[model samples]
Target: MAQLFTPLTLRGITLKNRIVISPMCQYSAEDGFTNDWHLVHLGSRAVGGAALILLEATAVSAEGRITPDDLGIWKDEHVPGLRRITDFLKAHGAVAGIQLAHAGRKASHSSPWKGGAVVPASEGGWTTVSPSAVPFTENEPAPHELTLAEIQQIIEDFRVATRLSLEAGFQVIELHGAHGYLLHEFFSPLSNRRTDQYGGSFENRVRLLLEVTEVTRAEWPTELPLIVRISATDWTEGGWTPAESVQLAKLLKDRGVDLIDCSTGGNVPAAQIPVGPGYQVQFAEQVKREASIPTGAVGLITDARQAEDIIASGQADVVLLARESLRDPYFPLHAAFELGVDVAWPPQYERAKPRRR
Candidate 1:
């Protein structure tokens, strides 16, 4: 049987299979509100037979948004639409999950369709915040360096967001610590050049992320799981390394993080990343082995056989897919056929199931 089609449990939540819908930003919200587009975009995957369906990079504060259109759970008003989506996902069998994020210096950009450029304040963008004032690139504006008070406020934002995610009925919450976002900024020396307690040494640079995890855990229910996604390496010399990620994963696991979703690169514009199938899987393996915590493998994972091999080989506990899920929401269902794994299709789609040759 395909290990990818087998059930896996974290905390009190049991996913029907090992396939997880990796969080992919839609850049399709208005005023940080989720709408019908989000409903269909996420819900159809549940109906298509995924074990877990995660909402995109949702902002924990309005100013933390990657784009003006990014979804937000910073306010109580955002809970209703999220409730609608989670309710539907649970009713259909998939465990509803969400990735809570703050974009840091990467915030205030146009949506990809609108060219994804940094929008000036006059063009609807607000000043971005980070552990330091360093901009993501030369063309981007220098962000406001967060003061001690502001850093504490951001932690509260995550706490409140976690509370709202629980109230909205999501079973899993992933702290977005990857992709050079706010948490990633704290982890990457290239992005965080602060001399305060939030930067300089490795321990100082990791302090904010741990503080956020502690606060989030205090607010989130014990029965639900908290996953933290980390970029295992910045892929540059003197950047955040896989060893640091392993140590961070161990610290996170000690702080009650259930899983480490491992991905790499995206810290600097000029960092050389060796991208290919399973390119990032070794990081997951090292973290899982060294930290003794479950890790989810992602990046260039496109086929059922490859996903199953990752799990079967003990490289990762979960195989997360971004582009593959986009290409086929029914990827799991199709994978079941190819891997000789039995998975029940939604009755409405049963007639469309592949037949034995």
Candidate 2:
């Protein structure tokens, strides 16, 4: 069997294959609620033969939303619709996962379609909060520095979200600690300038994420897997580094995080990231070897051979596809055929599948 077609077992959860549908924000929710669009969007990927279908960065609080339209699971009301999506994904043979996140200083922005800029409070955006009161950009307003009490509350919020995710039948939970979001900001020196227990030294900077993982682990089932995505490098001097990411990954693993999904940059506006096909794969390779943890490689990984090579070469345990999946929801199914891997197509789509080799 092709390496890409081999099942991966992590903490008692077995993936059908190595292909994962990376969480991509739709920015189509209202009051952080999921609707039919989520079901169809995630369900199609499951049916397309992805081993994992991860929901987008779901906010743990109303004010933590990336935009007014960002999906949320802060309330019990959000569970029902999310359950529907997870149910469909699992029924179609994919593990359902959710990325629980808090946007911090990046919260309350206009959607990418709206130019992806920060929104004003008068425009319905709330005051953003972070480890420090730093603005994402000079033009954006400074966020409120989180108090110790608020930090503790946020940790509890993640724990609650984990419980809600399990209740919705999601088998995997990934903490959105990357991309200069709330947790990433704390890790980056450029954004986090503080003297508190949650800031300053590297240990202090990573404190919130570490604590969040611990609380989440306590709430998330022991048999289920937990993942944390981290910006392995901020692509800027004085920013977070791949070396730091390796150490953090080790800490995360010790805290029960099964995999480190390596993606880079996004903590600062001026950081230079060399973007290309499989550009982020090297970080995963480094973390996987040095940190001795499973890693997921994402970013511009669009072709069957490229993904298969990643697995075959031991670069990463899972290949996460985003824009490519959007361009073709059935990319995994097509990939299976092209790579000579015999993944079963749903009975309804079997007749539509290409002729066997």
For residues 195-255, could you state the per-residue lDDT of candidate 2 as single tens digits?
Answer: 9888899999999999999999999889999999999999998889999999999999999
In model 1, the Cα lDDT at residue 249 comes to 92
RMSD of 2: 0.9
Summarize candidate 1's per-residue lDDT along 71-113 as a digit string, tens digits.
Answer: 9999899999999999999999999999999999989999999
**10 residues in a row with least lDDT, candidate 1:** 1-10
> What residue pairs are clashing in model 2?
none
> What does each candidate score in C-alpha RMSD?
0.8, 0.9
Which pairs clash in model 1?
Answer: none
